[model samples]
Target: MSTKQKRFIPADGLAGLKQNFTKDALSGFLVFLLAMPLSLGIAKASGFPMIFGLVTAIVGGVVVSFIMGSRLSIKGPAAGLIVIASGSVIAMGDGEIGWHLALGVVVVASLLQILFGVFKLGKLADFFPSAAIHGMLAAIGIIIMTKQLHLVLGINPSELKGKEPLELLGMLPSSIMHENAHLAEIGLACLLIMILMSFVKHEKIKKIPAPLIVLAVAIPLGFALHIKTDGEIAGFALVKIGSISEAFKNGLINVDFSGITTHTGIFIQYVILYSLIGSLESLLTAKAVDGMDPFKRKTDYDKDLIGVGIGNTICGILGGLPMISEVARSSANIGYGARTRWANFFHGLFLLIAVLVGVQFIEMIPNVALAAMLIFVGFRLAHPKQILHTLYIGREQLIVFLVTILITISTDLLMGVGSGILLELIINLVNGASLKNTFKTNITLVEEGENYTLNVKDDLVFSNLLGFKKKFQAIPQGKYITINVSEANIVDHSSIVTMNGLVEEYKDGGGKVLVLGFENHRQLSKDPTSTRILKLS
Candidate 1:
């Protein structure tokens, strides 16, 4: 008889700390190096005092780590939320009062996130089509790039203020022409470092985070060029992190809620954006990190939502920007061999200590360096491969993706996503999906001894995925199972991906599974996960 080796799961809480303290602490320190500059950049781009970004990171790391369900994700301010945060700040008023009013919106949105978790609505993230989500992210990337490019070229902030994304993009040529030579030199150098580091295939060198390298080069260059005391370089060129301890002294009382009454419409708009988008991004990041975990551990997403909500609530009260399970830092944490949530805690603790004692060093970081880093981030999000991959999936998917990006760039995030969903629905119906069953699942389960079968009879699409997943997961583990989708009018990319995941889950639990019914269907593209529709023959 052959014996199967069991997988080792890491301990949790204090025991986990005792077991993996050295490894976790090292990962935390590395993540801290990466997070510090990115957090400052995200905060600056979001129109809040840069120091508040660290505040959000501290709360996310120190407090949320203990409560969050994911073991390895690093929570902090993310580039993804910059658009909504900046918009809220601008819509509320514009300056000190604007930030205060925006804090009120963050509080309400975070409360709603808590409600979402309490009600077990994290599954709602599954309802969004994969293409639409990618489109939304790509749109965000484009927006980030457009707004930050001028900064990278050393254009004056006063000239770029109040300009829309398209307008900013249009001004790029002019900005480049009139760019400050010395500041641009630092920015371009930092951007070059980011680009080069990304292609580093050597494992040890790759482990050194790119942001740290950017800082290493930019800080010295800033001093050599005399950015702080120079007459030519603008005062805003260097980052002003300010005093974190002093900020917190009055931060607790800084939140203003009068915007709820004064700008009622905008208040509601931002609340929806902050809660819905933030929750979606966090859940998605946690899921991605789960896939990357060495032990194949799954996150309790509802619990994670609650934890992140608590973090956001605290950050709001302290006048900080919204936070999420930031993908880059979290990935870096895993890469550095983080063993438990303690890695997140240590990262936050280190940030707290640095701000308390190392404020001067942080303040030396130039704004253009941070902008260069963000521009690199934006490039990754909007990379051409994303578009090519979507096209490789299916022309319909490409259309939906492009539509979402165009509408988002021309209008706003909510409208762009809404339009993408609507267009996807129309495409499904035209492909023979029944409108009545669009959000309803029709899978009949049959059990015989230890053998089980699922007969899918309706369109299997993203809108109805949650119900299908619930039904699929209800089956007893370690049994022989078969799924027949022959009768489904259409099987979308989202449904195909979910079914693949469920099959893996079943197999991992020592169950034998078979999937049938694709024989008479026509795949929309060469991709294995592309949508399928019944052949008309």
Candidate 2:
């Protein structure tokens, strides 16, 4: 994008502000309305107090929106980052220090992200295959689905905290079987509202954020039905906002940083995981948002990375949750007819205004309503058919997808991604040398008394040296190996080093090895005085 195109703030101040104010304000308000329930839920999932989620949402809307270069992206505590933040909090304090240290960690992580952007490392996303990305996301959806089932039923699944996710999945039905009436009613209400909103077809209805509608209904129903009748429902009972003051008060949290270095490995682990996941999620959201731009604005990924990094750094410092480019809010902004980044700023202002104004009445909303919204989000993410469709693309791609999904769900994100990359490298290596244009490449397997020739034409470099090493290693227990690089244009130092290593390995294996090329080639060795073909007898 050119300078004029990338410019978000119009040169004309007052006039530009006026031209955008109303439309941006409406878009911002709509996004804020959509974000409220989600922000709170994801915060809770992240092991933070409900109020922390709101603070992050507010900061993301107000602070990050102002600085972010990407138009129409909504920033908040994403479900994706909950794993990192939760792990960070657990490792940092476990009730020892304040929340300040956690803030410091966020700042450090964000700085790393900003540096990644500065260095133009956004292209790293291309290294991972598309199938793996899909599989990773699919696994996340499954995790969310399993976790939220308890929320949907109005029971504290965390009560069974030590239980495995699969075990908890089996335990949900029995909990519902002996459920409290209030819990059952709230659960059913959330599910019903979610279903209706998700499946119902109407132009107007589709535009309205379903979660807001659920809240509007659930709050009034809670008051009318007095779901809290006869005191606590169980050993633990439902909590209603007693007053705006209390709701705000319960949200204040502390962070601790002293032990962070003591747990330096854990800290780095969280930072790396958060940076990787946050980048992928944000990039995907940015791409989708760009597709929706009416003026066809394309986002600069590097610029977005820096913007989000700044947002997250500030969020960590201020006790707000880590922020990312959220698709939920981004799509909502687009659907609401937002034209520019101003829409994001206005949305933040709307959230601030809503909290200030709605405080007195905000306590009336029910948890089940928010749970319903999450259930909806989870369903949208867990597209089971996607797996089958991906499989149709290729058998190898299917294996990659399945392996990634299973590993991610069973182990962790990093392991799954690493496994996928390793699998891809192995597959590519097995396919043998394929050359295009004037380049000629050949690999021949030899056994018994047969002779094998590995040929190459055109530029030969360090990477291709690995192939040579593999071919040399394949020499039979009592067979000779020959490498023909006579037609090569060039060989890097690394390639020569590799050949020397191979020659030693081959001789140690009691196999004969020969290299036929370097005798007449210039720049073939580190020392100009040597011109003999590197050979092992």
lDDT of 1 by residue, 1-537 (tens): 223334677889899999999999999999999999999999999999999999999999999999998999999999999989999999998888899999999999999999999999988989889889999999999999998899998887878888899999899999989999889999999999999999999999999999999999999999998888877665788988778667866636678899999999999999999999999999999989988888788899999999999999989988989888989999999999998999999999999888899999998999999999999999998899999999999999999999999999998899999999999999999988999999999989999999999899878999998888998889999999999998988999988987898898689778999999998799999999999999887
Top lDDT hit: 1
Candidate 2 positional error at 248, Å: 9.5
Q: In model 1, what lDDT does residue 301 have? A: 92
* TM match of model 1 to true structure: 0.98
lDDT of 2 by residue, 498-520 (tens): 46655655565567778777764
Candidate 2: misplaced stretches above 4 Å? 1-16, 91-102, 234-255, 431-537
Task: Write down the lDDT of every candidate, Cα atoms only.
Answer: 0.92, 0.65
Candidate 2, run of 10 with poorest lDDT: 528-537
Against the hidden true structure, what lDDT does model 1 obtain? 0.92
Best-performing candidate as measured by TM-score = 1
